[model samples]
Target: MSRHIQDRIGRRLSTVFPCPDAVEDTSRLGQVLLRLAQALAPAPAGNPVPDSFRTDLLAAVPQLRRYALAQCRNAAEADDLVQTTLMRAWENRSRFEPGTRLIAWLFTILRNAFLNQRKRLRREVEDVDGAFAATLSLEPEQERRVELIQLQAALNTLTAEHRETLLLVMVDGLLYEEAARVLGCRTGTVKSRVSRARERLALALGTD
Candidate 1:
């Protein structure tokens, strides 16, 4: 891997898989890592995956889950999208060009997979009216739940293009050029979309 790629993967690894000695418990991260490991287990006998490729792919799972959750708005669906992205990425590992942004390539696959799945799964119900929220047990963190609901509702109001661009740049930490590659658009377009997305999101949250 190139120096830049190594740096990027190292940063992602620190977030997705923190030093075990520093953190007492990482059951959540462990679960995600285990799922991704299983996803990559069936590589062809003769064509084994390289250590660097596996490491980079594993490190990207957290960002993938965030983007998937923003798009799907349901934890189960987001998990499925992430698993599908991992599976597809592993299967097409040979097509990936080295010395390039692996996360960008994975984002492209993830976005395409999400779009294809959306077509078949349009009937899935959403909590647009907050009816589902009413059913949640009133816990100490109910205020936090309400805030998240408001944020998700604000996110849902943006155009698909705006939402995707904002998530790629702001949430996933993709540079403008890398996000442009994933979105198949000009860097200027990505910038404009993110700017507008922030404005629209703020307006939706009644902060504009």
Candidate 2:
């Protein structure tokens, strides 16, 4: 097997067979191999499936729900989106590569599912004055409002690429490298886009 596959198998093994603490004579490598065999062994008769397989999905549900709610105007729709995302992830669990960041993978799945749903519902008219719009709050100060309005307008004017990068970095608190990974771009591209976006925002706010 390739080294990458071996490494992945090794990691999965470690999670399954942690070394005993009291044994002084057991070599670390031996413990690792033992763990690997145990993890790869056929399931015992009547034994339930491992819970670790669902660890990523369980951990990500709250975050996924929050993200969905933010993207969808309706709470009911957001719940449906989360449920769909979970179901899709569960069905595709076997395709997930070991040792990858499962949460990131789940997020990607949720994002794609949401975008697809959005495309399907594109013909629906949005409410301009309902709870969705009212959920948006303005800044307390008049100056802050003006600044925020200017920033919001500038954001609306930006290309989707620029806006997404900026929002992912600033609003979502993703590091530039992580943001680039999500965007499927190079780190340098993320940096450049972020820098340009800041400059554009500053100019739009008349602070440049």
Candidate 3:
């Protein structure tokens, strides 16, 4: 890669410096060494991932996001899935082999993670068409007066964590990853809070 690319990635990844160009070598060991260097460059900011490795991560983001979007079909869920994949990949980077396809490895992790999430939500009914509001069976639940007042009161009763997650994901239309970025927590934590908050709201409103 060019020095400009390296320097740009260095800034983006919070690395203090750029890396030297790889020496020409056709040998397998040389190839492995180069790959390892790119995969594990030391960060000057005390981050484990250096500019070289971080470039790889940044390069993979778009593709990873596409895969996530395909799997979840929900922007928020897709962003959460992508964040989970990246976090897990960072934690388990040592398990990645040098000279192998890093993108393939990341894609594998994304697929597995998506499937696991699907398993967790399998029992719950999803409203893909936004039809839930039209299907309310109770007259009181459909009434505007009761809904506006009672729902507001119930929301006021939620813990800060639960309320924020619900509003961020539901009202603001932000992805879980975006909310997590704003909230300084993992996407899974945001997901849990939203779930709990919804349950609490349901219980308070006599909807569950």
Candidate 3: segments with Cα more than 4 A from true spot: 1-41, 44-52, 123-208
> TM-score: which is higher, 2 or 3?
2
lDDT by residue for model 1 (62-161), tens: 7787677656766667677877888888778999999888999999998888878878877543433432243333335865445445555665576768
Q: Judge candidate 2 against the unseen true structure and give its global Cα lDDT, from 0 to 1.
A: 0.57
Determine which window of 10 residues in candidate 3 has minimal summed lDDT: 12-21
Name the better of 1 and 3 by lDDT: 1
- lDDT of candidates 1 onward, in order: 0.67, 0.57, 0.55
Give each model a TM-score: 0.63, 0.54, 0.38
Cα lDDT for residue 202, candidate 1: 53
lDDT (C-alpha) at residue 6 in model 2: 31
Q: Local error of candidate 3 at 102, Å?
A: 1.0
Residue-wise C-alpha lDDT for candidate 3, range 1-208, written one tens digit per residue? 3445333222321111112123244544235335544545665565566454566765666556645553454555766776677778877877877665566567668767876787887843232232222322333544643553445556556675576456555543456776676566899998889777766656544553
Best-performing candidate as measured by TM-score: 1
Which one wins on lDDT?
Answer: 1
lDDT of 1 at 53: 85
On lDDT, who's better, 1 or 2? 1
For residues 115-203, what per-residue lDDT tens digits would candidate 2 score against the true structure? 78878878542422233223435547887656555555665566767766665565544678777777778999988887787677666
